[model samples]
Target: MSRLTDLIARTKGNDPQLGADLEREFKALSSRLPYGLNFERHSPEAVELPLRPVRKGDKVRVLPERGSTKKGDQRLWQVKAIQKAKKLADLELLGPAKTETQSVALDDLVVVAEFRDTIYPGLVSTGKVERGGDKPFHTVINGENYHALKALTYAYRGKVDAIYIDPPYNSGAKDWKYNNDYVESDDLYRHSKWLAMMERRLLLAKDLLNPAESVLIVTIDEKEYLRLGLLLEQLFSYATIQMVSSQINPKGVSRGGSFRRSDEYLYFVMFGTARPCRMPLSSEWSTSTQSDLENSSEDGSPVTPDWTSMMRRGSEAYRNDRPSMFYPIYADPITRKISAVGAALPNGEHAAPPKKGLVAILPIRKDGSEGRWQIGASELESRIKQGRVRLGRSTSYGFVVNYLPDGAYADVISEKFLIQGYADDGSVIAFSEAGDLSRVASTQWKIASHNASENGSSLLATLLPKRKFPFPKSLYAVEDALRFFVLEKKDAVVLDFFSGSGTTAHAVMRLNRQDQGKRRCISITNNEVAADEQKALREQFLRPGDADWEKYGICDFITKPRVKAAITGKTPEGGSIKGDYKFTDEFPIADGFEENAEFFTLTYEAKSAVNHNLAYARIAPLLWLRAGAQGLRIDKLPPEGWALVNTYGLLTEVDAAAPFINAVRQAKALRVAYIVTDDDRRFQAIAQQLPRAVEPVRLYESYLTNFSFSNGE
Candidate 1:
């Protein structure tokens, strides 16, 4: 038996209840631990209730006295009876072992569930914005993010490249919700509830990321940075994690007798081979330390160049080891250019007769010992023509020779070597750029565009007139953060669950416009009304499901409109936005984006209510996203047995495989083939018939199939 099983058997001798309890506790603890050790999870315990109206026989946990300092009951209770007139409910303790009762106000008890509920996830299209091209539309899903994440796992499991989120900071204001109720600073369990909410959502988000190479970027402020860091550390213990301090507020927000708040923290959680890609330094670094650099050790020594001495050093430098490597490099002492390369001399023979017009540089050690060149005469001749072989400083014998080997040459062209100014000799000068987190002395990101007031709020006002969405992220700040991960990844599928004003998508669109990348962004947010808006709506007897209330939601009013405006170059008022995005890349907002976007709202569909053909329309978006989310989407089910689009092909019926195969072979742009079937034999045979370049995805009767994304086209 396993260790846990053995322990349970030994403990169940006198009481089986104790053993059952031990088993349940062990599994929960093991989920959080590295090796399922006995260390109990370190957390503030609290019960998170579901969002539903109170009903008879519903399990619940009574809320702690609101605005009171005391903690509330953490145990589950079943509603025994409800008095509608009194707005009170009688509750009995859950579980057969405990018999307890209480009567609480209806507002205090929130209906909860002890068992996991089933949900038939579906997407309903709300709108679309197009630039009249074949670009795969970036998507914005308007719903509670948790459910949206759940639905994404089915379509994009292990396919996402990066996830960047700027969730609510949980800063004691009612900026966020827990089980449909706004969690305020005065609530004693606010931190625990926030943690619980984030924990659930992040766990789901984890499924969507490619475990082999993906990054998770989360932005937070001072209020919850410490707790958020600990939570991430606990979840991703095996991955590399880091934090960055970005200055969003230059002047800083002041509190009585406290230091001004100037910065927020960003946690970058990298899994597998994922890491931050370096870029040309512009303004991500602070200039305040300029004078300090002059006084520092960096000014004391000159950095070494990648090109090494042609004379072999350290390993096998002698002529006897390799006689062919002992050749002469012919270069002019005045012009410092290679004139010719001389053949190697016999093993122990003396120097060959001198050649006129150029100085012959022989390999000589610093201690005056005979050494060999790194390469032979034949290779040296080819390298000299390509500028890889060059002349170095004059030695006592002659001008020393240097050469860039194949590996160093590869690094230069691949941008590992940062090109500095060249020397007088015309040798390409380059320096090293850091690939470490500790390269900077301080953690502050004092970028000018990161200023929240100017770039975030004011810039947002240009596209959206009079819409009040608090604390939207700076466009360039999100762009800079995303650029490090996805700049090189042209088709990276990025996701943002807490998309407030759609800045994440806007950032991605800007990135695409600059480099013409095919990167797609998926953003999820709820259409929640602001606190003041809720009060106003309630006064007019308009609740949440009302059309008037829904129209003013954050998704409908702010996120969707902002995305459309940013992409179409027109504000909500149908006028061109009058400003240029300044930082990293500069372009007028009126230039717009050559991109496409679609909007969706999450809907829970009952399988009993819909047939297979009708359900296909709901999941068409998923199939489009799975097929690289590029080119024209096969947006509907194949009307005539097969659907052939730019990026992928789909076969709806088995009998049409021959024509489908012919079409797929002809379309050079098609990279994926979706074959719908129930039989394993049919799927295998159909997949084998496809061209070598096309990846086959099999979708079965229940929508469960091998969703394979062949890494790249």
Candidate 2:
């Protein structure tokens, strides 16, 4: 029988209850220890009968494996010693802290069970390869696509810097999908499902950011904007929120209802640091144009103006000088400050060329024939053909070109389109109809306004051509708002988890591409929705293929297969698309209290088995050994030529002159800690022999700090 079984049998004879209690304690203790030691029973009735035999050197698995350590903490223990009933068998486990051990009843303690041949199993070796160097440069890619967002989050946990997403307007359209299906009906669970989806990703996403960094920026309409805002508060407690307004279609009211509502609102949330220190607020605002850069005529001061003032005042001149640049802008029906657009102009749309105030008409041919110029036509044509055309200014004015021929440029550009308008009755009402050209447009956007840019429709068409993506945002409005936060040259990392059509990425790329900045971005997206319902009815269209579309759309590249095409920048099949940025997926093991722990063990010298009642008698042998080994100087000797350890576990000072101080007054013996309870004679004898010997301290002083000896000698 095992030692525990024998102990139990002995105890049961005297106190059956104590034996049962001891057995129960032992079982519970075993379960809590690490390793696979389970307790099985052939019969619950005869509990203490036959315990499978346990030999002295029987090998038994003990403790579980200790996983990786956290960033700054150290591993505490390699094995743990657990003591069960005082009489039962004791075991030492070599494994992780808080590991469990299963136990089988004596009757069923499978003697043939496998034993641990290896001391520590399942531990990760340090030789395992990592992704890159110990330190690596990280970057973030922003875009309004969801699948990409999910993929990135899954791939890189605890590595992202920012997360900015602006979802659909939720205008009763089939935009967002749930569970690989569309949210058709006003299903009460629809919103909840969306929240749950976000929750799943966010729970994982939260682990992705470093403790020092945070997430930022998620735009939404009022329909579900408030709900999203609250959700953000719950998810990211350290987030700071703000609403930015962007002019959609300057000429509001496209659906033709009452007053046109064009202004749109974007909800932005910044995470990590309390707030970005020294973030350029001007970048969030519209960038300055050429006209804005001109010096003030009054004092040669820079005549920089806000976007609205600049646009309104410069509208006339913008239209007259560059009629092709005119486009309508929209606003929100409720708040005039919020533009109908998602902010930022669409891709490939030409911005209004910086106004130079100088205007030059194509010189009419001398014969009144088109393209038949009089003097410098031949020279200009030759230059144009060679793509080096530079029309020379008049000899009177060096290289100066003028529209007003005044001092310096002012804030507003003259609006020729609106300046030369007439009513249907053939009556010119241009000046009268013209409102405050310098007044800032309403925060709420209008759909049916005349301040539309010439490329407005085309730009919108390029982004949301067939109105496939409901209430798609204008790139300009988003850019304008981003200007308030995103800087041009700084190493900013932008994130957008709720990417729609990859707009945020497009914007980030455009910003850097325009300025040649090295700003990086990260975008997360889940492919749960469809691009269109007609093709995949009730089916998920936002799948891996959709992500591929975006990736291929940008650079016509697929990172996975490009390794084979590295030399030629072509796939094995001779495909042209080749990805430059390496893409990878990762599953990182994170650190947490519940996930890992620190365990410990206690050790001391053991003496021959003897029922000794004296406190010092029970512990003196071990104390003496430690003192001799550690060379603790003291003047003491117990009755048996050893140091006495009192019941209190502390050493009694032999010298009355200095009770606390331990000094060597004897040549044969040394000072040591107190012993087990009850040996007074030994204490006195040691005191007589050695003058200043005191009880020794505990082994793990870092753990047991308050231990003391009670034999007050």
Candidate 3:
């Protein structure tokens, strides 16, 4: 007997109650560690598990290789009894035919269970578009995003500058799927499933981000924002995290008996010194009027238009609230200018009058309530000496007090008062005591331009014509979010995994067009069919696995077409519907877009091929992508007799080694060369002959290790 069985038997004989309690505890713990017995699935060891004896009551399935099998033969079975000595078991057919039993060898049975990862890493190039130029080409990858991310890790690990993803919100209207089936609201572990899906992909994505200067932006609604926030915090503990509430829908969506939902959230996870740039305010808030004074010194000037309020208001504006700011100001009765200031006393009273000849001014509201001044007694004294404080018109009590103009005191006063005076041109004149004018960004964001369901749909419809995808993100919204980081780093690399309808890529293109920069984007998405399309396909007997199903799916039908139209300035029908951009004032809106991009699909290579005999063609595009997709093909040497890939080249033929070395020495741009040869002596010979600037690497020897993976079972 096994150790557990023997222990149970001993416990039962000693004390029946103890044995029952121990057995119950063991059963509960066993359920928690269900995958422990299948250690081979989780182990990192290179070897496979050896054959082992089947346990009684263990679930199994018959091998599909067995000939002449009945319809029910493929179903799961239970091991009723196992003869340890013979290595055979009495299997009772499960499900409909539970009464029947058959004696089968243990080798013919396999465990029926779930494992963490099912797909292997491999990439198959479906097609390519060669719009040759100095412009960087963007890539749209079609596959399961997880596997695509894994494949990309071999090439782009620690190199991406930014990643913006809009994952499924898990609203439970048959929107997202797990194991090829929609995860309905009634599912007991729906939330767990959503987390599991996001966790796996996010972990892979973490590997691709540049450790020192990268940012990850994730957008989510109320359904899973809390859980996702905690998850991001857990995974990225070393990074600085900030959450912003974005109003994507100002009108708001009505929920049952609850407040209308008008906002979603953005989690900006910054690594190292990555930060958002101070962008120019929106058009409505951009206009500003400069002061007329020129050549003013840093110190306060006599003719400076800058001024500030003398009285304080709001919550902490009372004398009892901040007694230090409630002192009295002495003004010259003849000049109507502040002459002296009194300090605050220990008993919450003002100090003795500065001079008996000057008039004392106290802060009092129109309702006869005591109030505080904007500055403390010491600051008031300094301003009085500089002639910054002056008396104004008399109140109903026939008393003159200090006052500042609406334009000059706007920054110190309430924003409501500033808006009242500057509402004509949306322009405000903010002056400093040093006589300088500066622009400040407003905290309040306008929500009209960020309507996702409406603006996003209209943007995609302009390119796609059919509205193929559901509820995409607003083009300007994503552009605005990325603009914070990409504004200065125009050549930065951006990635999007949940690239529904490819709005993120479209935004990147628009931003580059506006700035005349060479930014590159990489978008990954799965070809999952939409809910309505899936229902229609099922009605037509064309399920998910059917040969023609993928042709009608989102990645191919929606994402690829949208990206193509946006790049080439023409619709899929070969007609031009392109117009000028509207968002920028620097460029004409009617100039149209002139950009380039390529499309690719992910596929897997056999484990044997990747390990023993990997070919250059299988991994060339990956190299090209890593090189910023500068050129389309790596098949032939350039006209200069050497192929150039971002200052790197691979010399395939031994006969071309001399020419490659000569090219390396002649071309000032070349920095690295990969010599492809099986003979180590020949590789070293070429490596030694290369210039000091050019570093030679042996193909399939130096780089293949990065692409290796576990057995693709």
Best by TM-score: 1
**How would you encode candidate 3's per-residue C-alpha lDDT over 397-484 as one tens digit per residue?**
3244443444444443533222223212122323343333322333334556677876688767777776567789988788878888
Give per-model TM-scores: 0.68, 0.33, 0.66
lDDT of each: 0.75, 0.34, 0.66
- The digit string of per-residue lDDT tens for model 2 on 480-546 reads 3454455433445555555444445444544553454544444333323244432332133222224
Misplaced by over 4 Å in model 2 are 1-159, 202-205, 209-215, 253-259, 272-457, 460-471, 524-713
Candidate 1 structure quality by residue, lDDT tens digits, 582-653 = 876788888889888989987654444333456677766677766766667676777788989888888889
Task: State which candidate, 1 or 3, has the greater TM-score.
Answer: 1
Candidate 3 residue pairs in backbone clash: 122-603, 124-603, 580-589, 580-590
> On lDDT, who's better, 2 or 3?
3
Ranking by lDDT: 1, 3, 2
Give the number of colliding residue pairs in candidate 3: 4
Q: Highest lDDT, which number?
A: 1
Stretches of candidate 3 above 4 Å error?
Answer: 1-120, 129-132, 283-444, 543-547, 578-580, 585-592, 635-647, 652-658, 675-704, 707-713
- Please give the RMSD of candidate 3 to the true structure: 11.4
- Superposed by TM-score, candidate 2 places the C-alpha of residue 15 at a distance from the truth, in angstroms, of 38
Sort by TM-score, best first: what order? 1, 3, 2
lDDT value, candidate 2, whole model? 0.34
